[model samples]
Target: MFSRIDRYRWSFQDSHLPEVTLFAGENVAFDQRAVRELRQMLEVQGTMNRWSSHAPEAFPEGAGLQKVVLTPDFHKAKGIPVGTVVQTRGFLLPQAVGNDVGCGMRLHTTSLTAEQVLGHQKALIPKLRRMFFEAGRNIPMNRLQREALLREGLLGLMDTTPRSLQEGLWQLFHDQDLTHEAEHTESLGSRRARNTLGLEDFLGQRDFTRDGQIGSLGGGNHFVEIQRVKNILHPGIAHAWGLRKDQVVVMVHSGSVSVGYTCASMIREHLSRLYPAGLVHPRNQLYPVPNAEVHEETVLQNWDALNAGCNFATANRLMLALMVRAVFQDLEMPTDFPLLYDATHNMIWEEDGTYIHRKGATPARGFEAMQNTPFRFTGEPVLVPGSMGTSSFVLAGLGLREALSSASHGAGRVLSRGQAMQGSTQDLDDLLRQHRVVTPVDFARTRPDVAREKLKELLQEAPDAYKNIQAIMETLQGAQIAQPVAELEPLITVKG
Candidate 1:
């Protein structure tokens, strides 16, 4: 157990962001699309209001079953909105878990520092370019290797990119790290979901699932960031989390892999038809389905499948880290090698027999159990990677917040990626160059105005786009949400 921090009550208060209401109100006119979604959402929300009025006991003693603190980065998502959290009695909504099951962020440090990286940056770019192509030819494995993969990109299909060889890489990985207990913890590379019928059936419906989806990043908000540890608030906590001031680290933020897309795509269709006609209960209608078993089985399978993809993504970063590490190794870079401080932005959890849906939030636990292990939390360090091109943070769970001990997934999203590409790349270029961040992957990297415009759009995702980290930590201070240790800012970013 840890010492309680501070108390801050959270009751349903006035809306902070404009053009949004907590519940249906009579203040402003509604857009057709907004009205449609609201009308439908309220049908379930209204029922919840009545049920809570009648059965307040459904909510825990003190929790009162608050939905979620939708921060500025809030947006529409699979079932629950992106920032939503569901603490329930006996149900799990698959949509709240989203398609990319177990999508999260992982941060690790290599024995490389800013100056050392500066020396080898150009030489490393070509190798960095090669890493993308390396996934295809050299990696082995066919279907079996693909099942356990969690990174959404590697499992199903890919856009312009090549299929991911991560599954093969995962199998071969153990051949080298025989001494390390890498496989004992959560498997980084294995395959399961693609082999299942549920996933298969789901993928059949959406051609996109079967299309070139392997080894690609999730569309919308998921991204990867290279950040510098701006500061450390608690050095003891920071050391426990393997962090140091001025340390440069790679933050890979991704989720669920392709199988999740298959599962969610299929399940969503079933629910869309089931609602308004089937046994749409007051509480279960918005995200309706048969029993929790069927869908839970679907998502659970997705969990296994996505984890495989994520494992491969981890492998991708591990190799990438090795590349960075190797370069720094030559330069005698002054930094730490990366360990697992994974921030899973989208995933689901089984807590006390209830489905704690973390739409775009990190699943946090305590550090006592995870300390000195790969997971430096009570379970493992929950990575709360800030927005792309911004700060990323390391969080350890206290696991006391009964509303299902969780925290905001990240600096969420103020605008979509499409919106970001609209702005000037110039501003983004200046900012990136000024910050020493590099965007060599894609998306108008050389064009300044194009990148700047894009940056401005993503500015919607800037620090201002999120709940003030201090405020969020303080508000949930005593609630056992997550404890902060160190802060990481962007240095070199790869946006896929």
Candidate 2:
């Protein structure tokens, strides 16, 4: 369905459909149906035609899909490919952004070396399991703090002083690190929560209490991994980014947990209600909310919900990093885990009057776009993690406008979770043992029933479930979308 335009690019051109550009190698395959569904989102029958003459004003001039680009990890997902990047004028497609509003990658450079972390593995693994899986996530936030997080994310939390819990986990925050954290975080890791829908329980309280979802490493591919810098692909950028050979760093892959899904569901329901009566629904079931006067309230509410959900997600990652710090503290190791960069791959960005929706795609802006941040000299740090038992890469965004300044989020899933579960469990065990990956469960100590369930989860996320990350990196570099700075090998991995 696509013609190879170059070694790393493919173009699907149709006179009646919007042109799509896919960035991948021959080894990567695309779901034909996903490409068709993507085309449907841009055509007359797909979206604009669904609006009734009952509301002609809703159909504005020059309002439709504008551009589409897929990263190397392009694969089938609900409605669109996982690595799809689409830009639209005068409208927003929440489905393109997906349920995980601010789900993204966060990287931290630590002072310890791989030898230091690995040396403590014997005593460290159980503590990690206890803290991450058991009742050890003790992050307590008052209603005000939660409200600030919802309102302005990390910036809001930094501005507000916690009146309770000045010791222990709360000590992770310091005035000196506050501004530095914001400076390194993508977009300051804040979004204005204009509307707080379905979040009543998380707001309006003066007392500090712990919530289950805030500091959690949610299921699926989400994880907290301690990695060692395995190789330095670009020594100049690696040194500039404070990455050294064999240095230990923490990589967190997570999102807003239930908070993000709740907001996404609300937006979807709102769109469903606004859809014109007696019209055929979009074939892919993907809906778009127009940015028009008639739909002003709906649009505003959506933006607010998106911002709030994203705020929660950013806070969730920060809390998770602190939890990791707590582990280091108990081990009497250095707990200063300075954030290298925190960025969201799944979100919407308004650029030059166009909404760029990225699902499992990272914002890879060049030095010019990042002039205000510390990374202005080197460009944005793109954190692309691999599947379990693989090496992750730290790349610098080249910010090529041709690709909408985007890159892949991970070595995109090759197999569905169901398909991955069908893989051999013994293979997963061997890989875990070989790679020295530490999961939350101790299969030998756990009950057979519980072990089986945990093993299922493990098998679903096995490294074999994903494409070759080395190939993905090659495609990325060959396409000139991003340049690899350093490669990291996982030393200890904590999965929920």
Which candidate achieves the best lDDT against the true structure? 2
Model 2 residue 349 distance off true place after TM-score fit, in angstroms: 0.2
Backbone clash total for model 1 is: 66
Model 1 Cα shift for residue 170 (angstroms):
6.7
CA lDDT for candidate 2: 0.83
* Candidate maximizing TM-score: 2
- Tens digit of per-residue lDDT, candidate 2, span 46-144: 566457355668856777778889898887777677888988887888877788889999998899988888899888888888888888877677777
Off by over 4 Å in 1: 1-8, 13-79, 125-138, 148-195, 198-215, 270-285, 290-338, 367-379, 414-426, 440-480
Clashing pairs in 2: none
Model 1 lDDT, full chain set: 0.47
lDDT of 1 by residue, 404-481 (tens): 556666654443444545655556556655654433333434465565444655554443343444444443334456
